[model samples]
Target: MKSKTVLITGGSSGIGKAIGIYLTTKGYNVYGTTRNIAKYPNFNDFKLVQMDVRNAQSIKDCIDEVLTNEVRLDVVINNAGVGITGPLEETPSEEIVNAFDTNFSGPLNVIKAVLPIMRKQQKGLIINITSIAGYMGLPYRGIYSATKGALEIITESLRMETKSFGINITCLAPGDFATNIASGRYHAPVIKNSPYEKVYGDTLKAIDKDVDNGGNPIQVAKKVHGIIEAKNPKIHYKVGTFFQKFSIILKRVLPDNWYEKLLMNYSSK
Candidate 1:
């Protein structure tokens, strides 16, 4: 059997990289994308192609390049996204737009590019990497949460729409995992006298700490591989510590104000 081809966006580091390396070990043809191919001088895990998820043309070029050599694209993992944290009022509008573009629309772009090809072949798989935070709005990370939440909903719709074409789509919402996401995250400056300064500032530190102490990303990779091999994938999947995953269930069962209070108390901790 010919090896199945897989494409992952923002694959140079973090979860994307972990997924790429693991899939490669499984003998899948993996191509990871980075906006700047020159950045990784020593990357040899799989294959790194040039792509900026924000740009449609770049995504197309990357997909084209992959198909040019391999002739078949089987799986696409939309994993490229940015983290944005700040009080929603303080975050620049442009920055909010950028976050949406990268986190939500970026995945949509990849799906658009791959759908035609996948439909032509009459079979394909797309796994959208979302965040558990997206299940609810957090204190300082509202923008990031909104972005991921949007993608999560869209995934549900896309899955049903594309199922007839033999295209499978599912979203995986991960809780915090140890990666460099905190470093690349855009932080709106904490104005000295702003009303939310102390609270937002404190919450920001806790956010980074949560990511720093999170679980190994390879666990996410393993989940992805299992999804790939499944005969019928579910619409939603999440990988995280017991507490993190439980938080979603808590939100579902708790009353509105009660859940808000719970989140407030958790953020304050």
Candidate 2:
């Protein structure tokens, strides 16, 4: 009879914001965290916490505030991330570290902070927003894909570990949802001075074009709503346009050499 409480990271914009709005409208109490809550004044229905996932102290403070106020967390959505585009050889070490910290460790930190409360309650859901890139490698997205891939593995392990605790873990693997995530792509500062700059310059431009043509974020949010409301959420859910479904099938059915060529051909365009 009680309304469920959902906590989302990076909920100010894009997929996170869409999901927050949808779930809030559905009568779930929602809390969202962002580095700049002032920038997102439209989130009047949900509590906004100023927290940066890369900082341990900030995460602790944010979680503590939520626990103090809400007392119990019914769901935790790990959606905070960044995009890095460039050849691995041309990418700087700092950029790679930042990408991993935000996309991978950010979710781990949030889950760790929320698990105790969920354990106490004896029932909860953890949803990880990963990407189709998690399942397969892609050109110019080496670091980004690595982060999502790591998350997919972690989600699977957590699902198995938490089954007995009445906590559910689901990894939502969406393929190319239209979001500002594309605009957040960071070009390594070292690339400007690196010898392989020319090799990745054109590839980065192509990546931007691909993102611009990606599907809608609202659709992905709808999928998130369905997953959360379902009596039994699947281990992995993929949502996107027809192309995404096709890609998922290809990745599973096609041979490795053929899949590599297919991805390379798609990326080159």
Candidate 3:
């Protein structure tokens, strides 16, 4: 069997890095992108590229580099993203815009850059790393959820559009996972004399606590491997602990008022 080549964004750490390491062991030629490549110690059998997803030129250059070096691309995983956590009112406009650029626009740029190559090959896979927040709304995570929500729609459209070309698009919607993403969250600057200061402050604290108890990133990576290698991949894969599954199911079955009350109560304490 011929080896498959995969290009992964944000491959230096977290789920992306875990997937990259696993795929390499599975005999895949993996090329991953990272802004700071030197941070990751030399890992065996994985190639690293310096690319920023927020920059269109960087994304195009990264894809071009992959084409020039590998000659063929079998898979493209859009996993590079950032988290901005705060209530909509408290979150600054600039913060929201940056979040959208990194989470939504960045993926679009990467996908656009890679599609031409994938179209020519007529056979390829695109896996997008979304969050459960994409499906269920969280109290203080409006901006983050909006970005994931956009990704969900884009994935659906791409799936339908590329059906004739034999290209598969799958969105991996993992619940909270223990990753640097939580600690690395960018908070909107707090106003010194704002009425919502206490509320926003409390929300941030709750978010941090939830993230601390999230599931392991390695588990999510294993699920990603399965998704990529599966003969017929599902459009959405929800991988998380029992609570995550329960919450998503609840959101679907429960009434709006009941769900809102439950979420508010849960987050309040």
Candidate 4:
């Protein structure tokens, strides 16, 4: 049984919870973070700690507590993030800031807190949760795409900067999954006369439908465990419906106009 400690953010539900529970069964010591532990009164599968990724101090404190006891932190999963929707022009400025803070900067905060400990240990892994949308901006979820894309770039850069110290970092660009994310997703208020109102509403509904009927979160957790066990992991990995995963290939090979039209049609479905 592997005894290394793994810390995962946003573990109260969805992929985070799935990964936490799955890894606990695999014999790895698991610690999961959530802003409110009260919601999980019966959460006994693994340890759950209070953490808010948007707050740097909260992140630091959580990692400190884990390292204070665990002594060696093995894996860090940056999965705690939020989603925001609407056309770029109409999305509230504060919402955009909050989205980026949670999605992009949030990972950096966790990584910053754990890097020193991992580097000292001379071995660690950081698995960033990006998205298929990170590969390309979706119509109404542009900010969400941008935030995840930023994390992907950050992960790539971090891999090059940390490998010499034996720290590995990679991103998981999942297509869509059945999760509680939609319940918490924020939508920008479209004005009664906004030009984007029609397409935005249609696209939002389609995206939500796609997510509501998407892949099981356990599939993602299993891949995360495999990546953690592997001797060498890729810079980026994809998990989700076959079509969403294939979109990456299409984005690379298809003509610009064709791909744009395809994306538009799909988003507007």
Best-fitting candidate, scored by TM-score: 1
Stretches off by above 4 angstroms in model 3 are 38-45, 189-193
What are the TM-scores, per candidate, against the unseen true structure?
A: 0.99, 0.92, 0.93, 0.97
Q: Comparing 2 and 3 by lDDT, which wins? A: 3
Per-residue lDDT value at 121 in model 1: 97
Model 1 segments beyond 4 Å from truth?
none
lDDT of each residue in 133-208, candidate 3, tens digit only = 8886787788898999899988999899987888899899888777788756788655677776777778778777
Itemize residue pairs with steric clashes in candidate 1: none
Q: All candidates: CA RMSD in angstroms? A: 0.6, 2.1, 1.8, 1.2
Clashes of 1: 0
Winner by lDDT:
1
Query: Compared with the true structure, what per-residue lDDT tens digits does model 2 show for residues 77-170?
Result: 9998999887777678999999999999999988888787788899999999999887778777888889999999999899999888888999
Model 4, 114: alpha-carbon shift in Å?
A: 0.7
What lDDT does each candidate get? 0.95, 0.85, 0.85, 0.90
Weakest 10 consecutive residues of candidate 2 by summed lDDT: 188-197
Off by over 4 Å in 4: none
- Model 2, global lDDT: 0.85
